[model samples]
Target chain A: MTDRPTIQRILTGISGFDDIAVGGLPASRSTLVSGTTGSGKTLFALEFLARGISGFDQPGVFITFDERPGDLRVNARSLGFDIARWEAEGRWMFVDASLEAGEQTPTVGTYDLGALTARIAHAVRQIGARRVSLDSLGSVFTRFADQDLVRRELYRLAGMLDSLEITSVITTERDADYNGVTRQGVEEFVFDNVVILRHVIRGERRHRTVEIVKFRGATHRTGEWLFTIDPEDGLVVIPVAFLAPRDRASSERVSTGNTELDAMVGGGVFRDAVVLLIGSHGGGKTLAALQFADAAYRAGERCLFHAFDETRGQLGRNAAGWGLDLDVMEASGLLRVAATYSEVASVEDHFLRIRRDIADFAPARLVIDGISALERRATPRTLLDFVIALGGVVREREITTLFTSAPTARGTSPIMEIAGITDVTLVLRHIEGPGTVRRAIAVMQTRGSAHDRAIREVAIDDTGMHVGDPYPGILRLLPDAPVPPSDREE
Target chain B: MEDQPPAALTPMATYAFRMYVAGRSRRSQAAEENLRALCDFYLPGCHEIEIVDATEQPALAEEERILATPIVIRKSPLPGYRVIGDLSDRSRAAFLLGLPDSGRPSPEGQRL
Candidate 1:
């Protein structure tokens, strides 16, 4: 670590926010949070104070200029913040500067917001507050006619807060999503740090992101990071790509649930490996996933199976056809099959739900069947982010995960992008013979270990998947024609 | 223009006004001076002025939702109206506070 005098920070305690903020807002300094309407600017401002009071025992004063204290109190209840109780406990205070409905105050000549500044100082002193939030300063700008005067008074207010050694969040509104920093175009210049929240409609879905524009003598992660407003947890930023790679790579092997597939992958896959199963509709991807889950149950370990392409009933019927009793495994508490339509929610919500399930069940193995079905609901970039984030979660817990996807028509499939992050990849395809369409399987990559490099025929009977002898002269027929050197020896 | 006041005002009606200020600042003093002059010229003996220093009485200012300093609230004579800023423009301030117009014919031929 450099011995430079880095600016001190106060942890906001917002989920996944501190990771990107490099700690939190600069200590005892004001930061501007600007956003468009309904872009969660108020929520960010409220959470900054709520979390400070609850998580850090820091009292705060909320100076609301647009919303009343009662509305804020009621709205905060949905996010598990008891503002009334905090008020009763002398930890939270509100300086109600919100204008009454239809009650306009006409200006005569010249004035200053000294009354607001005095009330704010009084509230801060009453509660001994160390944190203050002035939400949506745009209302003040709209209330007054002179922009320069308002800007000057707000600048003085910020200076006073600094002298009080109070860390503050002053929110402002932006007219458009990607315009200047604020609606007034001067609010950002008054503060040392600035954060912007954006809500963009992409492909008929709302994608929320937060970015740290500048920190002024401080360091922070630069970019737009995805976030979702959870009712129970408030605004949760999804810092997926920023997660540090897991340092400990487990070398112990775990079975792939199929004897032939295990032999093909040099005995088995690593214990904490993320495996990708790529195939067509009828190429036995679901069967491999089911067998993998069954093997985990047989080993007395818990498994979570999430299905997007099939319903639970259909999956149960398919498992019965393969002579595996899914109900019995579920009854034994070793297997859980959760099936849902991918279009029911955004990919980020699905990710949060899966994360919640993993935390609740603590499974040792996970199987996500038909991730490509989710691709229909999200853009390729979001889908790749989902996979990367999911990879980070499973690998952190050392839970072996298997993700199945149907091959895309184009050369650059979303699955191909995911393959780069997965520890193992298995490709299945239907090879056309002279009179019959036969299935073949190939182990494309195994991160640490390797074994057979042959195109082997795979057959499925009433019993289950069965691996047969190697299929010769099949390299040229495959798409992309990736001819392995071992085929020459044969 | 007729110099007659609007029929709504009665000579016996007492007008009550409360002004919020920030201590003895220059703007607050200017507002006080302008307000006294306006009241003396319009409703001389019928006006009651109560001055509140918001810096010393923040809770009262908060209760009144006072954001800017040197604001005057017309408390009585029904229908309360709030006017912000230091009241230097006596004619406009008189009109906004619903005071009886001064019998002075000026620009725009309107009674001040």
Candidate 2:
């Protein structure tokens, strides 16, 4: 790559957003903020202005339509912004054109935004503002019957702000039926940069995502990066860089917390490899993962156990019964256990929480006790995208991760899907014969090693686990044993 | 212009009008002229007219919620009124200003 002059950026101060933007926004330019109602477009704009004023020493003006400046101040306060103080201190200016539609408003002739432009110019001058947000342009532009006139006015407004050297964020309402970023499609044409906010509903949950549709002079990460509006933090962007690729591969390996099981996978799992342990409910998947946790802790490495199906306390006690001493590891700060139900938060929020934990803990070994429970929280496609994102995050950090999931009767589940992307796969199942039941584990696939193929009877006890030799003879009495008769016919 | 407040005008005019106009636009200039003529004929010496150039003073326009150009507003007389466009039609302009039908001159051509 050749050296290129870097485009100057104004840091938005929103968490994780700068990473996806490769920095903040391009300075002294307009960025279009488009989304349907309740998708947090207004909040995004407010947060940008608030952050600019408070954090970057950049004063701003908020020109609004349909919402009064007083009400906006109140709403912003509820979101933990003290815009009222900023306005009082003359660091901010709010120009409201929301009530301009009624008869009380001054009526003017066709294609005249002279008054609006003058008011904005006066506000920018009053505060010497570096940032400006008009939330929104749709309500204002909808007053026009002429599309061409609206387009011209929008271009003129952008140019006006550009001439003042103020970087502005102009919000435009997006309709559910409309295809373009803005309601009129004029915003995208006028502004050099556009950012789209989407609220995707899965079941009863709304997953909020932000995507930069276009950035004129910069190369941006092209994907929908996740974001959530915190009542206190305002807008938090989950950067795509968390999943960006690593420069070089590491050949290090870590134990699975069991000597016999480690040997079965040819001297334990490789560093940075994602291992999937597929099993039915209560098929010793958690126990196998705990063994890996124990090994990691014993190696003096940090471990993070993110549990979806069980409580952290329950996991601690369960590991204690196996003599793994997870409680002691946690007490020593060698291990951290966090548990949350998937239904409590949207899939994106849950990912953010997990990402936060990973960032704070910086664990070398990570284990998600159950991914199937997370899958239950979202649609198949949503879950797939989330898992892919999660996989990317861990893979980039070169963190060895173990995820457990229950297999369907057809051997299909999130585990099966993740197994393809992961480096190793371990399938665990219950073997039933007449009136007896036994647990068996088979190494389906393992990267960087010659893994065992034979299914083995895995025994778990207080001392740990024992991997018994090949149980091929016992498969005759089990259902779907050794590929069954259908496989032979096919 | 300020010294001569239009001959035959009374000091206690009941009706008050403010016409908002952009700079030298043909439509705005027509609206301003039409508004002055309408007031001169209808209210005669009983009304007051104030012409505000929106281009020169946009902050006032924004404060008044001006969306378009060449708009006439009747600020007094209890409920305010707004008229969009050039205000060239006499009857429509009369209706917007809440003028009585008899406010117009007869065929004999009465002057203010």
Candidate 3:
């Protein structure tokens, strides 16, 4: 390992902190932070160490003389750090030496900062820590009397961290006014970086401000950055450039398999687009997704189909019966069917199982039969998140995906509202007329393209789903006007 | 009491719940009624029964997690249990409840 700091990602697991630090603390070097009591000194250290464990997958050693690790763990949940659990996970090591209340005078190396540093080094070797911290170096100094010795120990410890090439954050309690002046102002000169966190009561509001005093490499805003400690999000560091959130998606669409569905769409669903086919029961919403998969398979594009509502064999047979050519397709390795249920398979586990398939099979088309299938165990929001994340995969690999949803009960608003994210929305309905039930198809809306708004009767026979005529459907309910059938000549 | 998380107190068994169904007029209403009937007649005691009249309390179904009338749910017995279907079918209500193998089977021999 080199003695110099590496150009590495800071890996602060704290959600907002990494972004605020513009991706994280400088690796392979120590940063000194000094603050008074209740000024959020310990919180910053805890956040750094805990986040290193969870986010960067780094092990951590916290050397302390102030309080028991138990107290720290309990206190940390409010800051979103389960210190004890991290210790249990073997990612955290606590070196503790507590003082009994009212203990008497001691000076000059009463606390072993050097021995604690060795233990921290040992834990780092054990857990392979890329980061470490010493809670309140001043605590050790509190009991020691030799100023020269303290200075030497402090210099040696910071140099050791630098030599080992490990990123470190060492906290020191300032004497109320020494936010700028360190103990001899010596620790500030020795450490590679110095960050000061202070509490400022401005006008009636108690505010927290963080300022990076010195970092060896790269520049940061000179003005103090404002922040808050929320119970859920932990330490939230406000980024200087956060007003413009990133727009992660480009306009796109995917295929629905059926030509009528395609005609309902402009040509095909946009690449990397998430399309939702929603319809009432027997309205062939699931069939519509299958129709898309079949067309993709026929066109030499492999498709991965996850049928949560039906069996894989049964789905294949059904498609074959409906003239979608499943047998030849599956034999040709153009189609993969996974008939899974959320009961036996958890939503996340199921996603994990198919994550490889999405990566390995790299299908030109992917169908989650109905995203609603996973929405049982997976909430609509989570399901939407998964779809959105998967959309990135589609964008990277240039693939299309189709999701089916049982229309939100007959009259309730659409349950599967994947519409907002789709390049196209196809609506299916079973319109009962002339003592006969007819499957109807309509292009409700297609973003960025002109689509047919006419409601047409849809059918699936020995051939496939056929869209022919506009019927007096949800789009047409006026009396004295007759709607045409799919097979009828107008 | 099986030594689980506090949140686990939220009902683990969403089955055997009740659905209040009165009648069906519109497609939404019919879907809700069909769902309720399917859940009730299929799941039986696994679900509790509560059929209210829309005519009596037309405003009852309004302003809920649901907007339409003829909605149904498993009474407030379990934590985090949901209210679903203004008027749905037996298949969905049955599947939602995770009814026993003895309960309604799909006409196509499909067990949801």
Best by DockQ: 1
- Estimate, for each residue in A361-390, the C-alpha lDDT of model 2 and write its tens digit: 999988988877876666554555566667
Question: Which regions of candidate 3 are displaced past 4 Å?
Answer: A1-114, A118-255, A408-416, A473-490, B1-112
Q: In candidate 2 chain A, where is summed lDDT lowest over 10 consecutive residues?
A: A476-485
Candidate 1 chain A weakest lDDT stretch, 10 residues? A481-490
Q: For residues A1-490, write the lDDT of model 3, one tens digit per residue.
A: 2214446646656544454555567777788877767777777777788877766688887766676677888877776677778777788877664444774332111222333344445566666777777778777666556666666766777788778877888887766533476655567676767888777665334556677777677544455655556555555554322322334544545456666667667777676565767777667766677788887876788999888788877787777777776777878999988888755754545555565588788788888876666656544434544555455455556667777776432222324335666556777777777798777777767767788878888877867678887776355421112223232211
TM-score of chain B of each: 0.82, 0.75, 0.44
Report candidate 1's fraction of native contacts. 0.85
Docking model 1 quality class: medium
Model 1 lDDT, residue B48, Cα: 95
In order, the Cα lDDT scores of the candidates are 0.86, 0.75, 0.61
The iRMS of the candidates, in order, is: 0.6, 3.5, 33.1
- Say which prediction, candidate 2 or candidate 3, comes out ahead on DockQ: 2
Judging by lDDT against the true structure, name the best candidate. Answer: 1
Candidate with maximal TM-score? 1
Candidate 2 docking category? Answer: acceptable
Q: lDDT by residue for model 3 over B1-112, one digit each (tens)?
A: 6886543322243453433333433543454556556655555544455555443333343222221123345554443234333333455444454444424456774432
What is candidate 1's lDDT per residue for A198-274, written digit by digit as tens? Answer: 99998777899999998888888898888899888888887652255467889888998999999999998888999
Candidate 2 lDDT tens digits, B1-112: 6986553323354788887777777877778777877777777787788888876786787678775666777887646778766776655566656675634444445432
Going through the candidates in the order shown, the clash numbers are: 1, 8, 23
